[model samples]
Target: MIKVGIVGGTGYTGVELLRLLALHPHAKVCAVTSRKEAGMRVDAMYPSLRGYTDVVFSTPEDAGLGECDVVFFATPNGIAMGEARALLDAGVRVIDLAADFRIGNVAEWEAWYGMRHASPELVAEAVYGLPEVNREAICGARLVANPGCYPTAVQLGFLPLIQSDAIALDSLIADCKSGVSGAGRKAEVSSLLAEAGDSFKAYGVAGHRHLPEIRQGLSRVAGEPVGLTFVPHLTPMIRGIHATLYARLVRDVDLQDVFESRYANERFVDVLPAGSHPETRSVRGGNLCRIAVHRPQGGDTVVVLSVIDNLVKGAAGQAVQNMNLMFGFAEDAGLGIVPLQP
Candidate 1:
């Protein structure tokens, strides 16, 4: 069994990882760290994990993480870079579910995340953990940087277009809306139910942190810098991200066939039938991105809709997928969950 250690096991992403790993056949939870919640049973804090995990939260110093086969940092951005190097040196594979090593340019990452990167040297070595884009790299990587929730949905939506050079690169747009859980399990006035509930508005219109990460990923895929307008909105729901992507066609190509053929073999990315509108709820609680393609009146503009459970495919589930690849397990081993429905 692959012994696993998790840092910052109190947040939504941490518990989501625990919940998913509990069902994984070849993985075992060896330790979970939380400075504030040390000594508390993980299952006690998150009852959903009650019968699945008996691991207790401990301080990072006492977690014995060096002995685990792999360690997942579900902590905030700055936390991972400060600690991943040590773990990697000890022969433990590291997966950071934060922005610490996602961006290739250190100065650019610092400007957006607003912190001096703790381990900039490792940034170049850390593989970006978007399985669809970096599967081979992740397989051989000792350190993996998991993509953010918004970037996951947006990049996946525009991937086929960019790869095929079918879209006007300079005019790409990602209009995304995500559930409240995307903010993380923290107390803030903006995230309060009283304030965010019953409201539909966009934030980070000027520029958001995920913008550069999305651009970086797409640019790498397109082999050139692509102009993109990424705007993210906070929805009233609790999970999932719906990204409505737009791009002008540079050439005539079957939009449906393009998306379908691109993701036909991908187990997690579902390309719905032509003219279908995928709902966020369809991917809720599962590591799946359901997409649909359309052309308005056979116009030059193409609209692609992509949906994913922000905490699942957008975060924890994708991390698990990377772990599976790194360790040579089935990609869908622990992620075969059916989406939750009303």
Candidate 2:
């Protein structure tokens, strides 16, 4: 079994990893680190995970991550860079669920994130882990930088069109709404129940950090610079992301067939029936990403709507998928948990 260690295990993504790894057949969670809540039993902190993971949270200094085959950093943006090099040098692979190594350019990363990268030299070695697009690279990668939730939905919804030159690259706009949990497990005043419940508002319109990350991925597919306007909103729910991508159709082609043909064989991505609107609830707690296509009234405008469980497909589940690829196991191994449909 592949031993796994999770740094920052007190957060939403970290606990989600433990929840999923508990049932994973080929993996074992060995260590979980938390600087603030060290020495407390993980299950005592998260009663939902009781009996599944008995390991307690320890301080960062006490985490001997080299004991595990892979380590997942579910901490905030800048935390992973400080420890990634040391861990990888010790032959322990890393999968960062933060934004530390997602952007290819160090300057652009530093510009939006407001801090210089901690280990820029190792930036050359980290692979952007989007299983559908960069599967081959993730297989042998020692360090994998998992994509953000918004980027995951937007890119999957538009990648095929961009790759086929069916959509204009210069005029791309992605409007996405994510559950309150996407803000993280932190106690932010803005994410409180009163602030988020029954109220919806967009934040970081012009300069969201995920903007560069999305552009880098879409640009790679379009083979050109993809300038995009990405706006994200906070939803009332606890999980899931719904993204509506707008692009000008470069050619007069059936948008339905375009999406259908592209995702025909994809295991995790599904193109819903024509005229069908996908609900975020339909994919909650699962690794599935359900997307739909629409040719709006405007002749050149196409709207692509996609939904996914922000914590699952967007984070923990994707990390497990990467682990499976790295270990030569089934891509969907231990990740086939069906969506929780009520």
Candidate 3:
């Protein structure tokens, strides 16, 4: 079995990594690091992991993670850069679930995240870990930077159109909404039940961090610099992201052509029927991304709607899918998780 370790094991994404990896047929959870709850048993802290893992949380320095084949950093944006150099030097592959290495430009990274990148030199080497687009690069990569939840939904929704040169690069707009859990397990006053519940307000409209990351992904496909207005909102639910994308079609293309031409054989992504609307609850707790296409009445704009469980397709489960690709295991090894329906 491939031995694995997780740094920052108490957060939502960290525990989520534990949830998915525990059932992975080819992986063993060797270490999980947490400074606050260092001596506590992993399962004891999260009873959901009761029978699956009995390991204890320890500090990253004392976790003996170098012995493991893979390490996942589910910490804040800047935490991974500090530990990545040492872990990689010891032949341990790293997957960061933070925004540390997503943006290729260092200045842009600092400008959005508000902190100097701890290891800017390594930025060039860390591959963007969206398997659907960068699968080949991830095969032999030592470090993979998982895309953000909003970016993931937006990128996947618009990639095919951009790649086919069907849309103008400059006129892209992504209006996305994510559940409260996307904010992470932190105790911010803004994230409290009272503040978020019964509220459907958009934050980070003028300049959200996911804007650059989304542009980076689309630019790669467009073969030109792409600019977009990304507006993100918080929903009252616990999980999922539904991103509605609008881009002017460069040439006249019917909605059906866009659907059949792009996602015909995609397993996890389903292009919906002509008039169907994709919903978040339909894809909860699963690695599925449901998409739909529509042409605005008497307009040249082609509308695309995409939905995914933010914590699954957007975070931890996607991380496991990358691990399977890196280790030569089946792509859906532990992630054969179907959506949990009502």
Tell how far residue 198 is off in model 2, in angstroms.
1.8
Candidate number that wins on TM-score, 1 or 2: 1
Error of 2 at 129 (Å): 0.4
lDDT of 2 by residue, 204-323 (tens): 986898999999999898778987999999889999999999998878887888888888988999998888899999999999899999887757898999999999899999998998
Listing every candidate in turn, what is its Cα RMSD in Å to the true structure after a full C-alpha superposition? 0.6, 1.1, 1.1
Which has the greatest lDDT?
Answer: 1
lDDT (CA) per prediction = 0.95, 0.91, 0.90
Candidate 3 — what's its lDDT?
0.90
Q: Cα deviation of 103 in candidate 1 (Å)? A: 0.4
lDDT of 2 at 85: 88
TM-scores, all models, native as reference: 0.99, 0.98, 0.97
Q: Encode model 1's per-residue lDDT on 35-141: one tens digit a residue.
A: 99999999889988878989999999999999999999999879999999899989999999989999999999999999999899999999999999889999999
**Deviating ranges (above 4 Å) for candidate 2:** none
